[model samples]
Target: MMRQFTNQQDLVHAGISYYTTCCLNLKSLYDNRIELKTMFISKEWEDNMWSKNEAGRRFYNLVVSNEFWDGVLYAINSFEPVVDVLRRMGCGRSSMGNIYGELANVKREIAFRFENKEEHYLPVWYHIDCIKDEHMKTPLHLAGYYLNPLFYYQNGNEIEKTEIFRDALLECAHKMYPDQSVQERIVHQLKLYRTASQSFGRARATLMNFDPVSWWELHGSTAKELSTMALRILRLTCGSLAYEQSWIEMVHKKKPSLVQCNKFEESTFVMVNRRIQEKAQMKDRSCTCIPSQ
Candidate 1:
């Protein structure tokens, strides 16, 4: 929703490279990948470097470098409600908390330990050779992918939230893994996620009351203001009455205890952070990764 600059090329390239290192067994190689020591291979190779699909894969470094801190805070604020929804559904806040906590860990992995270190950290594009592709010679990062899927699913428009979520997930794969194989591996896991969701059915409904406009109302000023923000919510409600009623139902059903049905599972990115452990094998280098004219 909010954008800052226009350094897309660096983003795609960095994203692909990051994912390649994470998804593959090339941890050894990543340990040496310094920074903009290498160049992107091809434009077409960008797709698979980020995720199983394209949700947040298109961002560039120019935007990030100029407004990185603002973007991070904004993303965290937006994700707050999504996590709240999940919490109402019985999944604890601790679950989401643990995930963000790791962002500091990743940041520490790269630069020195700042006062408040982060886990969801990334450097610039480097070492094209370490990548095994659908994302060769591309530049992008995983932070966008991570937040995109979270937003798309929690409060996106009329499309299959899964599709949007999948795109973001794939981009994350490219940014966090070592090869396309990691993306491939996640495709199968996605099916499992679908099956588990389906299996829950009404039980799942109890956990999440379908509300399109509630997020709008809380995050937006008024229904009229929200309409100005995104029509997708209007479409999601199929009108406005449906969304309001759904919100009421969800609030009414908010339970403090776990109503577990087969467990809300997430495979791939949550664990197995070994991808980050194996960064690009290069010398400690410094460059904005934003390509100069």
Candidate 2:
């Protein structure tokens, strides 16, 4: 009996599982193509199968085509970067500060792969550019990068310190601290932070567990105004997966089959708050477990 293929959704769900299965399936086909060809072309099988089935002959032709394998490799290479980023972003501990840099690196890798032959990646490049224009490369993202001490200290020289980025950081500071006098204080504190951070060496033992919010809370006393701004920006959520997860879990738990729309919204709001508190507690626990260097 043959199983009927309905749609793409029936083939794979739209998540990490889908990408994992796709990679596995492509690898299997590429690896077993020789064995499959031998079976298909063998005298007994050919007599019984190829002679009786048009689909089998068509598939054998496809298997022998160089273009088919090229397309498979191209798809795997293109989707691998996207899948890596998606896995990282879906983690519970993922931070907004890290996403912008990672996305930039992925774009660079994709460009490098198709260098000098831009036509090969024109479609992919367009999608990457669209993501940058729509979401990843915004002012808020720059602020996240600016406030992350680890990234700022290590990659500051690499990142283009454009006037726009500086202005965006200052604007973020103003929004967080609306008082004109406080804003001036924040500007001064930021200057002091820049000077001190340059001389401060990060310890290797604590580097992996470093949290910008906790760093500000500890060393931020010297630069209280700037620290507040850092904390605010660093705490911002970079991706929507967690929020979406919360809504999905809420729907599953509530089983709101016949509930009114207004009640559903109210329940979802409460669930979101609970989910946020749980995440905060988890973060605090993880922070405590990190040994002080």
Candidate 3:
């Protein structure tokens, strides 16, 4: 029998976060599919279902079978890691520094999950690997990871141990600087940053929000060159979620029927600017209202 599911329209319109959450919840259900299948195949359920219609009984039988349940579980497991990365990337404030490492972890996890069943998972692994090689495997990502204090400090030893990572980071610097002398200066600044970062006890604190851009702004004066590099890297958004959000808002503000054909672009620009101003004002007001300890 078909069951009515509520809020499907809302879920579809809600954006990436909501959709990912729904997928995560569905994954949990798929994890328990075996038990659910047993319940569906029970004598009472079989009697109730069969009493309804021939088609319903046949469908129920197919769903409760081992082959169908296995396929469902496999699909869920295969897509879970991808959904996780997408969820993070689709956030407003996702860290660019974390994307490279996160994708690598996803690749490793997928491999581990399908180690013995290579024939079944090889396609999935190959696709994910191709994405990693094409987009994620870049000097910019390596440099971002190296300069981000959170990853650099936490995964320093691991990063340093990896020859490819070291080479990529240096390669990024060389390309960016171009001049040998400037490259040497950049390297020196990176060393200085490492020293200063190590001595900053506050970096280890968990309560403080770790914003790489803000961190560089506050403490990066000592290593001027590296701070510039850090700021540039940190400013890069991990995904297009913010732009998508703005476009959605603009579309809502200028509904298709009501939008002027000639003035559409102008209207969208005005709407986006207004929204940005509103957000800025709200932030300023909140900051002013906070009482000092």
Q: Which candidate comes out best when scored by TM-score?
A: 2
Q: Is 1 or 3 the stronger prediction by TM-score? A: 3
What TM-scores do the predictions have? Answer: 0.19, 0.66, 0.59
Q: Give the TM-score of candidate 2.
A: 0.66
Q: Distance from true position, residue 130, model 3, in Å?
A: 3.2
Task: Candidate 3: list runs displaced more than 4 Å.
Answer: 4-58, 105-127, 178-181, 193-208, 240-293
Give lDDT per model, in order.
0.30, 0.62, 0.63
Ranking by lDDT: 3, 2, 1
lDDT of 3 by residue, 1-293 (tens): 22212212121212234445455555545645555565566666657745379886676777678887677667765776776666555533457676776666776677677765788677888888787777766777877777777767777788778777667767877777777886787787766655545534454463157577787777776667667766877788776344346565657575777767657777667766765564444443323221221
Report the lDDT of model 2 for residue 110: 68
Candidate 1 lDDT, 202-239, residue by residue in tens: 22333244332333333323223212222231322111
Q: Which of 2 and 3 is ahead in TM-score?
A: 2
Give the 10-residue window scoring lowest on summed lDDT in candidate 1.
235-244
